[model samples]
Target: MAIEYIEGDLIASGEEVVVHGCNTRGGFDTGFAGVVKKRHPAALDAYMEYHRNGGLVLGSVIWAYDGRLIGNALTQPTYGRAGKHISYAAVEACMQSIDDAARNGVPGTPFSGGFTRVSMPLIGADRGGGDWNEIERIVETTLKSVKTVVYVLPGHRPSADALSSRPRR
Candidate 1:
């Protein structure tokens, strides 16, 4: 299990699966959701369809396959109610996503060959207002035994250093 931090665009990182912090309501209006929706409409549409069909819920992870990019968009409920304070649900969702990948070999198609790598922004930190220390601990502990290589992409705004250097709660 290896974790790498890259300061760049999450979408263009080219990881096997790109994890997205999404709301339980299935609205992709802001944050990573908005970016994914703009770049891959099919992914967003699939997420919405799944949500409408009672598939998306708190702590649930949904994989939307993108034909154009030939990759998978892994969306999980980081925020139960949109525009509200972050909750442990985000951490649960994140852990669940990783566990699912390790056990199920990535949701949706495996992209090129299989699910060996994944890229994602800081779960529940940006819009979800989650504590970085807690989020980091949860992620590290969860993936400690996994074999997949995970790349954590920092947000574009604020700068990677700025976000990481912020005082931890």
Candidate 2:
């Protein structure tokens, strides 16, 4: 299936992805399945914690630092809440999670044997304040080899299909 890009409210349909404006407040809405927070460990942790607790992890630190669900992709623990940098070790760990997930399928679901659909927001956009292209490169490279479908939720318009087409560099 091709990746579809739609614009509206993130929480409206519990879509696989929801892009945020510069100052979007992650609220409780089933329209969007997840919110892409700018890369801050605390902020990310809060989002994860909220969701894991069955509260709201759309936009916060608790979720960012709390570790990520091993769904279709493996996510690394957020690093550098104090210093504004993504740790190398953390990156490796995160990549490994993706690898692990790709190999064995997510812990709970039955293994489909191929193609795990994973939707992720571009990391390091907010807190790291880095270039989107560079970050996209990192994400692309990390996830390229896996049999995973990445939902590249960027800005006003991100292509789920285009992301799927990007060959591993």
Candidate 3:
């Protein structure tokens, strides 16, 4: 149950799992998903394929295995539509992703067992129109019992500095 903050790229954070907030339709059009799509097309493809096959749903998580670049991706649905307002369910989805990673290894690799640490951007706050205070509270509460160390990436806005500096619960 440890948390650390580092001001850098979430994809380059070197954690076992990198979590991204995605839409239910599996579109990586912007934000961290766009970076992932550009850097690891294969992983993004797999995620979309899974979504196309009815694998992704709100409040659930799916993994995208990318070899070593960032270990693996844990995609959680933050909203059903791209520009819709976010809900507290996004927090549940994030917690579920962490729990899933702890149970299932990094999706396709045998060498890596389970995630010991995870890096994530501020879920639901960027494009999902969520309040940072509420999202932060939800994150801290949900991750309280988990043993994995979580690294939350700051958003690319002026207020991100204030958000990142919030004390971990």
Candidate 4:
């Protein structure tokens, strides 16, 4: 898979092929798109750049168990876990972002006039209190139905630490 993983602060990785993670809105000076739109010029530029480069901006929202939509996916970190459970609400939100990008004719999508590559983070599996496996399964299932590239960010744990931490690597 040409799909690559990146791990770092979203701003530091702003130029990433596709930066992925949580709390994107927090990075804004005044916080939130509405506030940034009115106050931060650079924030707007970064957002435009992200859109121009075909980034998938997953908004804040967490889904409930047995929910009908993925619009309420969680974006907070909780405990030792990465995120909350993958809910139908969360997946719907992601898919909607993709659809919006395609419709807007973003850079990466040559066929649909959208970016060819899309980068996103592990959603709904952190503080939102969702299951990792379920989230992975939901994302995988969604990806299987599409022809887009979705590169996920891996844990930022250092290589040496990861190797030493592994059971029998």
Candidate 5:
């Protein structure tokens, strides 16, 4: 199934897993990461502590909450716009992990039987300098079972058939 796109505020979707692509280097201090940091300080603390404890690894993920559910996919070695920082493999791996958590329940989250809806900004795109088409394909391929929503900022228009899950045209 293809990914569904929605133009709205991803940060305010506290009920959905606010997943975003970040580097293994740590610190949610720039771009969309910074927005996440400001909205969910506990996630930032968890990420900071996790980084300090040497949890740096591509394809890894860290889930944390502070009145908000945040999923940090360590899908890049670092962050910069000079070249592509996003790893296609890592993004897929991270999404697979999130798919597991969304299907079988995240170990520490308050809910059980996993999450029903998963939401995120374009994973591995934006500041990571990755291709959106590729990332969208990865998301569609990896997050098949659960309801998924890809949020974009306002002024961007979604497909007329955003509600459909058929393959991308």
Candidate 6:
């Protein structure tokens, strides 16, 4: 019905499609996208290929699957010092695409498990530099047709031993 916020790893959330906001410039070198990139290099490769093909438009989506289905939303242009790189409109459009693909069917990317549940971190908030309230609103309206799981990381900071192994997005 509504979005469900749970504390855990978005990478291991196990939803049919894991949605996350990414830059349109095609660099997954840092932040949540970085973690996704590290976990699924194929996803970055897919995005790069898509980028070269001129599909990396703002407000567009790229479906990536390398053992896990990832809905890479082109919601921003670049990273680095920024006020708000995240485009709320782009986020909305991306979410709509994911909802449509899950509820209906995306031509080439056939989703398994009927695409019932989708998970994401607080996309565009921490790294993308977006307001959580607005991002939440956008997703709420766009993904009403499917189950949305918003994964919030626990409060405790990871120790040095666990730093190298933490999953961000």
Top TM-score: which candidate number?
Answer: 5
Task: Name the lDDT value of residue 27 in candidate 5.
Answer: 50
Which digits, one per residue and each the tens of the lDDT, describe model 4 over residues 34-103? 3324533443555545546655245433211111111222233222234432345545555555445534
lDDT string, candidate 6, 1-169, tens digits: 5677776777866666787888988678887788988998878988999889987899888887877788888989776656788989889889988888787765555574348888888888877889877887788788877888877777623322243244432
Kindly indicate the candidate among 3 and 4 with the higher TM-score: 3
Deviation (Å) of 55 in candidate 3 = 2.6
Q: Give lDDT: candidate 2, residue 54.
A: 66
Clashes per model (N, Cα, C within 3 A): 0, 29, 0, 28, 0, 0
| Cα TM-score per model | 0.72, 0.41, 0.73, 0.40, 0.88, 0.85
Task: Report the C-alpha lDDT of model 1 over 6-94, residue by residue, as the tens digit.
Answer: 67776776664666566666567787777888888877877788778986666656666664322223334444444534556556555
Q: CA lDDT of each candidate?
A: 0.58, 0.36, 0.59, 0.37, 0.78, 0.78
- Per-residue CA lDDT of model 3 for 1-169, tens digit only, reads 4345455576665654566666765667777678878877766776778778987666655555656423223333443445545657756656765655555655556424665556666666667767756766666656653443334444546344454476655
Residue 45, candidate 3: C-alpha displacement in angstroms: 1.4
Residue 93, candidate 4: C-alpha displacement in angstroms:
4.8
Tell how far residue 84 is off in model 4, in angstroms: 5.5
Model 6, global lDDT: 0.78
Candidate 5 deviant stretches above 4 angstroms: 156-169
User: Which ten residues in a row are the worst by lDDT in model 1?
Assistant: 68-77
Clashing residue pairs, backbone N/CA/C < 3 A, model 5: none
